[model samples]
Target: MRDQVTSSDRVNYGAVIALVAISFMLLRKWIAGGVCKSRACLDGKTVVITGANTGIGMETAKDMARRGARVVMACRDLTRAENAAEYIRRSTGNGNVVIRHLNLASLYSVQEFVKEFIATEERLDILINNAGKIEFDDLFFDKRPYSPLLSYKQSKLANVLFSRELARRMKGTGVSSYCLHPGVIRTELIRHILVRFPVLKIILSLPCILLMKTPWQGAQTSIYCAVTEGLESKSGCYFSDCAEKDPAPEGKDDEVARRLWEESAGLVGLNPRR
Candidate 1:
């Protein structure tokens, strides 16, 4: 009886180990599924990526810098931005990586960054609106609390609107605007949320750890949009997994994009006519 019990315990442990291994294999396959694989270089082009102090944004900056582009890491955190820039420069041997302050939550900060960028840089080849927020019960400037889902969705919608409006306004310019879904990357973006809800964090921790894309993998679609040759003509199109994908029905509404552009301009104190 003792021997049979020991044998049963060994079998159970082996089965558990086998299950874990299979799970990891599946997760690895998923994470490694989509890749850009483009070797296009940026030579003299200038690229700006917002929220580039960490995660997919930083990875995108590093990839662009490796292709010989002048990369501006627009971030709200100066210290982290500088550190990321330095890392990119050293990793890519491209010393042209610079950091600029950009606080996407504040309209004033957005306008200020644009002013400085336009004044200093002679050309803007690529502008990537990569930053996003996922907040819960956030109060807008109107002092009314918005549902977390709506607040986050609106923030992402702004990225699409900004890209479309920028493409329209810069029609004749050499600049191109691209917005991408960087995949479900494992980044620090959810640290605060996880800290706030420990039980939820525990539930999500294993799957998130196994299945989510690393920052570099997540940035592939953005890098693809930025460096792909023919994509210059496909401005304002949404991209995912290194390919153009149809956005939601609302995202495709040009009228909404235009209206949002005007409203955004007003908020940022920019001339709508410009």
Candidate 2:
């Protein structure tokens, strides 16, 4: 009995399927953005990652632990950070993961965390301020309608400025700073926003699976900035997808950055000094 479909036709179908799969993978990789290929080991180095319990912060912590770095998981939630640190320890076989409480909303909390770190640790290395939300008083908002999008953009600009100033001041001191724009990720933050209007944004959420990066993918640029060598000279440069990018003109204003630094230091009770 001869089959309706010939063997050559079957091979053609298989070839088409294979091509589709490969194309899909390539598209995904492109959408996922650049990956950190630097195999620079972090043995004996210390990495402090804020919000290390969730999203890209967690992924970055796992990478640091895997690379033999001492991972300090700074989080507001102790239980969640403990769970994440335990998981990283088990998975990466690195027991040096520790957790410290850091509530960015409160300056006192940050000071306490720093005091503890300084008292215990001998070396302070990479600091990844991955996630944080400082409570803004009404004055900060100026009684205007709160817009998350606007606030987010403002915060990003602030990050770039802070990094730029930090690099400028820390020049010749062997210290460096970096700021990055992690590609859109399907993290808890995004999920919360979309989950609020699930039915309304069903179409939007569906496309995110292919269009956005996972936490692991989003963390690549952060890991790259932290571990890649020879980036000290590139510090203060804005990065996206693991490569240097030019920030907005406002971000490039040296005087503005310096002023922001001084004002921020005053807010934090740090005396502005060279």
Candidate 3:
């Protein structure tokens, strides 16, 4: 004889499952700190994080601040950045958090952000390129016609190109440029996909949670790149979870990277003095 689930029993079980799911998601949102053995290492150091208003960027900023680094939250929206800074300040009790406006989509904004950063600070210890977008339109899935995925791919490509250019310019300036892929964390960046394609989102998200890392897990790579002792020699390399990542077929195109660098500077109306 086996026990059977009645309608009421099924309803109760469903509610319990929903509750468990919400609890798990909430737990993932509670970001944690990193293990920095020496406080003397990070004192007075400065870090700039693009897309620091949310997701792994926020977690990274918080962890860095907790370790006593002066962290700048560079974002496109000033108000949102301020709010992120406030939350970080409250959460970590570190008042060194500052918000600077930066919009990666626009070369002009990128130049302005860099200019303002250089104007206010002399040396930059770490620059983390962590902003990205994904296209989930139906046409993109159809794969049979024109889609807008090209724009999103271009944006991600620009991030790496920008990092490479920054590394070249900062070669002797004691600044290190690092870029990372923050594995699949659910943030506003992915909210559009979830809203538009709920079924696909659920399928993709399940695998991501099982095979993916949390925002902090993703942030750890940048943390290691920023603070590790031997990263000076690894400046231009891309990282994923603190390990060197092979550039994608496109990312490895030196000609493309060079063109992107020059074009971006031109787009921002900045003359490359070198």
- Give TM per candidate: 0.78, 0.83, 0.68
**Over the stretch 92-118, how does candidate 1's per-residue lDDT look in tens digits?**
999999987765876667657766655
Candidate 3: list runs displaced more than 4 Å.
1-40, 101-109, 118-146, 198-209
C-alpha lDDT score of every prediction, in listed order: 0.74, 0.77, 0.68
Question: What would you estimate as the lDDT of candidate 2?
Answer: 0.77
Best-to-worst order by lDDT is 2, 1, 3
- Report the Cα lDDT for candidate 3: 0.68
Which model scores highest in lDDT?
A: 2
| Deviating ranges (above 4 Å) for candidate 2 | 1-19, 106-139, 200-205
Q: What is the Cα-based TM-score of model 2?
A: 0.83
Give the clashing residue pairs of candidate 1, or none. Answer: none
Residue 156, candidate 3: Cα error in Å is: 1.9
- Tell me the tens digit of each residue's lDDT in model 2 across 1-274: 2464687788899999999999989989898999999998888777788888999999999999999988889998999898999999999999999998877975446656765654332322332222223234442557778878667766666677777887888777677778888888878876667778878577877777877899999999898888887887786777889898777677787887787777777777776674
